[model samples]
Target chain A: MIRRKILFIGLLGSLFQIFLGCVPLTKTILSPGSPEDLTTCTNVFPVGPWESVHKIEAVITGGVSFSLLGVTRGDPNKRRLHSFLLTPEGFILFEGLLGEDGMTIQKAVSPFDSPAFAGGLMEDVKGLFLPPPGKPARWGRTADGTRVCLWEGPDGFETEFWEAKDQDRQILLRDDLGEVIKEVSLKGPFVNGLASYIELRASKPLPYKLKMTLLQISP
Target chain B: MEKTRMKRFLFFSIPIIISLLSAEAGSDQEWASLKEAAKNIRSVKSEFLQKRILPILTKPLRSEGRVFFQTPGSLRWEYLNPLRSVMLQKGDTIRLYHFSEGEWKPEMTQAVEVRRMVIAEISRWFQGRFDESKIFKNLYVPGPPVRILLTPKEGVDKFIRRIEIFPGTRPGVIERVEIEEPGGSRTSIEFRKTEINPNLPSEIFEKP
Candidate 1:
């Protein structure tokens, strides 16, 4: 009887640990290669503050779907227009504008006010358009031959930018543990190296994907 | 010369008079009865063009779609060009779908709750309950296709600068809805052709 109680306690401890482990995403293994020039690596990703209008159709799979007109501006890092979130039925969900003075939100309809969702949203948008924090720390290529550029951000986070041979660019924002918390992919029909398709995947906390298709790009 | 001028004036004036009379007929009916008239409408299907003009955008973003609505609660808002998405609502349940990664995927659960609110707002519009919200001041100008202008009150004024509604060719049918933003940008949804009280299958409300 005493042995059974001890085994039950051990099982409960394992379950609690598993629940805690689910907080972080599955760590992605990185392959090393020869260092390359940072400027040559980010040739495909859009830089500078320019407006991009896209038909944003967001789906959560078995939940609901909505298509709206989204306009994103600015470079990845600093102050930028971020992205304007709209609903298909002509309603403005929220207007996210990132200026030099942090970020400001207007017309946010309820859910965006939450600390978790709003923070996650801002991170994803910044991950997709803006450049990583600080400068490029290193450059290399993955085992899949996808060119990788790593930028060491504050608090020991590594933002990696990957580019395929075919001008397709992918961004992986990972923490110190090598867990890719966020992944952004910019893909083809490159018009002067600007991607027509972009997808952002958030892996930690709550996993969600935002896919944006370009309708028009203005320099 | 005087007779010819009088004759021309009469010709234009008669059509104007007739249009005013028809508009008066619409306005003379009680607003509640018009709400009842809206309930009389069984189903509606119309093709629409959505033009989103913003100050940041160099050109207006144009999209095409179809809008479907049924009395007592059902709506299918589908967009075809540029992007494909469908928002369907039947009674209390609302389902939305988008073409993602070449497959139809649903949207976030938050949108479902939002849709419920939107569906309620749309239902109020369908019932012709102009006084439903204190946020808008509804106006009407007499004509063959009467004009209903809705100007939003204070807090809501920033987002929805103005809303203009026009009656359809069919009596008591809605023709167009135009929403303008504060910065001269607007989203104009023009119903090219509209079908009123048509028999739409239940599958029409299902995700396609």
Candidate 2:
């Protein structure tokens, strides 16, 4: 009995050590290749002026609901935009424009506080979908298994690039502080089958989710 | 001199005569019945199709969806084709979703103008009462097709110019609704296959 107990404990120790080793090694494995490897890569970036419909399911702090709609393209830098919210039967609940400085939401049903609500929303959206300006300033690995490249701007505005191993595309982001102020992830064709999903998380939670799907690639 | 006098008399008398005739034709009972129909609708569910035309594009992009509304303050609008999206409103909270995003964002509901318009219209609808004092100056006119024209009052004119509701030949049913905006944008909804006051799941208004 004494010998069996000792053997069991030894086996458990070995297994624990193996798991620890795997976890640390996984971080390194996710690192991007040298600059030369990126140069030789054949992937092309997705350009915009795109539009697509999305079905959103939100579970925030345990509250859950669903919404549906389509979004049209505009530059976050320029901040001009158009989109529509529709019912399952094809009625337009709200329609509006998000422009450089503000936004307007019209024809909303109950619980929707149009113009004021939409203005803040468009700002949050711009942060998430637009890429960082200027240049990348820091390059390193995050403790949580991502290779990161960061760019810092005035007013605490910063952008990050996270790379995952065996993944063809990278995540481009603009953030304020630690919050994910704005971001776009590019998954390789393998994950979405030749299409990409762009996710924009609001700086503050809003009553809507905005997503873009790549329908076709244009040169 | 008699001919000249007669011409002057006819010009002034004709408008007054026409005005008197129209005033006599405007019966209060017809207006009351229309208001009753407008206010009595408790809930509504309908299918919709939206076609977007871009200035540079050759073909309009089309989408089909569904809309649901319940009294006091519950609404669910979802688009099931071309893409999936939904907006659900229950009480003071509204949630919108894009399935591709896989998340629902919370929004605030404090702004008054748009909210008030919606609430006022909905409450009136549930009660089956159409109050012109709140939104428009109501007019009932015989048309190429019979319709009720609601011309917006002062404050409401910024958004809507007029709305026309056409009752079905069968009575008590809304056959069509047309909303005209000040910007020349018009939306016309033709209600078909309507089911009124049907049993609807309470959870439909709850968060998903």
Candidate that scores best on DockQ? 1
Candidate 1 lDDT tens digits, A1-219: 999999999999999644523333223344644544456655555666577777775554444555566777666445465666655554555667776777777545546657666666676766666666555766655466666677787787777776777767777777777677777778888764457888877667666677788888887
- Looking at candidate 2 chain A, the ten consecutive residues that score lowest on lDDT are A38-47
- Give the alpha carbon lDDT tens digit for every residue of A82-149 in model 2: 65544332334556667755577754543334555555545544443444454455555544545555
Q: Model 1: how far is A105 from its true place, Å? A: 2.1
Each model's backbone clash number: 7, 41
Single-chain TM-score of chain A, each candidate:
0.74, 0.52
Model 1 Cα shift for residue B163 (angstroms): 1.6
B100-207 per-residue lDDT for model 1 (tens digits) = 667877766334454545455555565576667444556565554466666654444444555667767565577777666665657677787888878898888876
Say which docking band candidate 2 falls in. Answer: incorrect
Which regions of candidate 1 are displaced past 4 Å? A1-36, A55-69, A75-79, A140-146, B1-42, B72-74, B81-83, B89-114, B120-135, B143-145, B153-156, B183-185, B206-208
Model 1 clash pairs are A64-B106, A64-B107, A65-B107, A75-A130, A76-A130, A76-A131, A77-A131
